[model samples]
Target: MAATGGSGRSTVADLLAAGMAADGASAVVLDTAPRLTSPWPSWTVGQEAEGLAALPPDRPLTRSHVRHAAALRPGADRPDWHVLTDGRDWHSPPLTLPQAPAAWLQLAAIGGWQCVVADTPHPVTHDLLQSRCAGHIGLTRSWCELPYAVPVLCASATAGGVQALQQAVMALHAEGMPLQRTVAVLVAQTDGRLPAVARAGATMLSARIAAVVHIPHDPHIRAHGLRTVTRLRSRTRHAAGLLFHEVLAAAGASWGTPLPDAPRPAPLAVVSHS
Candidate 1:
């Protein structure tokens, strides 16, 4: 997942990981952001940091090294998923651009993980963007960042935000990014009913993008740190499920069959022009 900055890309990555795990897919999140915040803090102990410290700077990372760096959180409703982070506060020995692809390959080789979500920094440098991942999810709080072609999830929380999303879609088309790979996610950041402009923006976005999902603001998600979707409110979980499904589809992933215990969100009503 790539975000310009503070667009809650980490949160989206976490939700996607949880959703995949719930669906019986072994998932792992790779934190490539400069600021080493663990998306799965609920499971990571200090040992994760120690594992990072032990990594050799000179050699290519191996599956064993990745396992060593992997942190697990137990006792969730689903099987435990792993998170691989740099495990340090500062980006001292950062993963160089050349090393990123190798690191991703090593993680893929770790075996049994069906999905790997990466939370990356702004502009998503060319090297990382070209890596062999399923697809990309670009998050932006503002519409100004929507010109690229990769699939995107925009968070519209206000009237201006809505307008920005509409304009961004036009800019995206002008830039040659297919609207079929784009998505606009309506995030109700406030408690009151959604603004009319936001609703209209969602309608317009639905006409252009593959899907549009509305995620009502949930205090539980905001206050609670790093928890499963099961712990979220019904509406929040439902919206997350819809977004997850669309994301996987855009990535060309075979969702296979849903697990019996998996929480599946109802599909959002979309207004498509096509």
Candidate 2:
């Protein structure tokens, strides 16, 4: 989509800012709903773009719209927003991926932080992440996959933003500390700047990552202001939010319901005991 669209689909940069603001992005879960889905049943990219464009400019960009949009007119047009595919995973408030370098990561853990990985496979991103950690701890050569326990952030499918994305990936790596569980968040913010390093990095790490998230510099961009694109940004945010919720749910679903441990006998036959 054009950075400044006449049809008003809103560029990636606009969407990122608006979505972040409307949702009140916070350290934890941002209170916003960005649509999140998979490409199941295989809907054409053109069809998906139209569905996203169809949303009204003033729409609240809530969870309901996400559901409604998924159930579009053409039955086959329904978006695969729920299923968790191996593709890029998106989230609000962002998350990092692939445990940060061992040493830095340990420091972060002491500070109560953990690393979350976005499914970015950009060579630069990979190099950056790997540099921090050094030696494949668990990273794979497969399709944009990250180590287990890491979260993924999804961005627009457009290829133009690849450069900026590379920068984001590198930034995360640069900021990451070893031994700490870092959260690697990825998103496709179309208009944001991709540092020189990022561009170079992409050449080194292409098709290895799912996407990159170029964090907005100004909150006003994300807020409901003159520069914001309401509908598009909202939709993007909804998708991200849904992904976040899904990740949390999956983690919770793993272990079976907690069975009450047999009441521990008072210290196993405590003798005389004062």
The numbered model that scores best in TM-score is 1
lDDT of 2 by residue, 1-274 (tens): 1111121122222233223333343111111112342222131222332233233433233334433333211211122212111122234332222233332122222222122222222343444457457655332222122223323323332353444444544544454422122222333333466455544554454343333234332334334332212233444456444444434343334322231221211212334647
Candidate 1 ranges beyond 4 A from true positions: 1-4, 36-58, 73-75, 89-106, 109-112, 123-150, 227-231, 252-274
Model 1 scores a TM of 0.66
lDDT of 1: 0.55
Residue 144 local lDDT, model 1: 23
Per-model TM against the reference: 0.66, 0.27
lDDT of 1 by residue, 217-267 (tens): 778767775554446666665665677677666544222333223222233
lDDT of 1 at 104: 48
What would the C-alpha RMSD of candidate 2 be, to one decimal place? 17.8
Weakest ten-residue segment in model 1 by summed lDDT: 140-149
- lDDT of residue 174 for candidate 1: 51
